[model samples]
Target: MPKKLYNIDFYKFIESLDLHSFTVTDVTRYLFETYSKEFDNKKNATQFVYRHLKRLSKEGIISAIQGKSGKAIVFRWCTESSEDSELVHRTEIYGNKTNDLIVSQLQEKIRRYKTEMLMSVGETEAYSEWVQEMPDFAEYVKPHYQNTREQAKLMLGKVKGFERLLAEHEARLS
Candidate 1:
């Protein structure tokens, strides 16, 4: 039998953080220290904390501000007693429809690039066959065939990147 996965109400967890503003790293460390026994390791606990924070921010349950260096993200807890209702309103607007639009665009790009890569593969195969049948034209066909393969590789790379982006967006939606 498989172990069942349990869902944690992260909003409640965040609420228990006691209305204190904290950086993502600080939150991760705090969770890891509090629930060290529940997780296999600190890294796993940290990742879990990050996942919840992202979901909460995306759903407008919390507000995140980019740090001065632009790499560190500080998350502010939202509560009924919060002083800045306007800031909360702005945060609510953050993940509304723009994420969906970006996800849709990324999916479309992934689909188109995948199809192009397949076509490029077919063209490369045809070129190889032509070169085999006509040795004299091999010089002319070889460079084009290589170029097509390179193009296919680039397209595949793009598809992977777009797929990753789509997954991130979907995670936020979830």
Candidate 2:
């Protein structure tokens, strides 16, 4: 039941803003504070704002300029349309085979797998320490330790495979 940013009226959000130009961080913080219940967390708010900004740029309502730091992007409101401007949604954006949703979903999966792998590593270490402290319990702890290590290995493989797939998908889109 996650809230998707594409469903929100981002065009109206942009129009309501007083700033002519802003970075994603600025918009993310504003939205996170204004729509705390909807977003639930800063990360979710940031992703929602970033997606909307990208869609705005794509629709020509805003222009993305290079920021002082070469890697940073700044979005400037380029159009002076009336209040009834057409709302920009992800319907068009997600129509393509390789879209933001797919890329973000893949990245989220990779992050989850990496996190689980790290947790598994921690569990393996704890089990190793327990076994060293009490050799008599080695027989009981061996299965758990081995299973955690194997799961960590499996997670690593999954992460690498997904990363490769993501790269190939991005390359194809490019």
- Judging by TM-score against the true structure, name the best candidate: 2
lDDT for predicted candidate 2 compared with the true structure: 0.83
The lDDT for every candidate, in the order shown, is 0.77, 0.83
**Least accurate stretch of 10 residues (summed lDDT) in model 1?**
1-10
lDDT of 1: 0.77
Candidate 1 stretches greater than 4 Å from native: 1-94
Q: Clash pairs of candidate 2?
A: none
lDDT of 2 by residue, 92-167 (tens): 4445634777899999999999999999999999999999999999999999999999999999999999999999
Per-residue lDDT of candidate 1, residues 6-55 (tens digit): 25555556667775677767876767776667777776766777777897
**Per-model TM against the reference:** 0.45, 0.47
TM-score of 1: 0.45
> Which stretches of model 2 miss by more than 4 angstroms?
1-92, 95-98
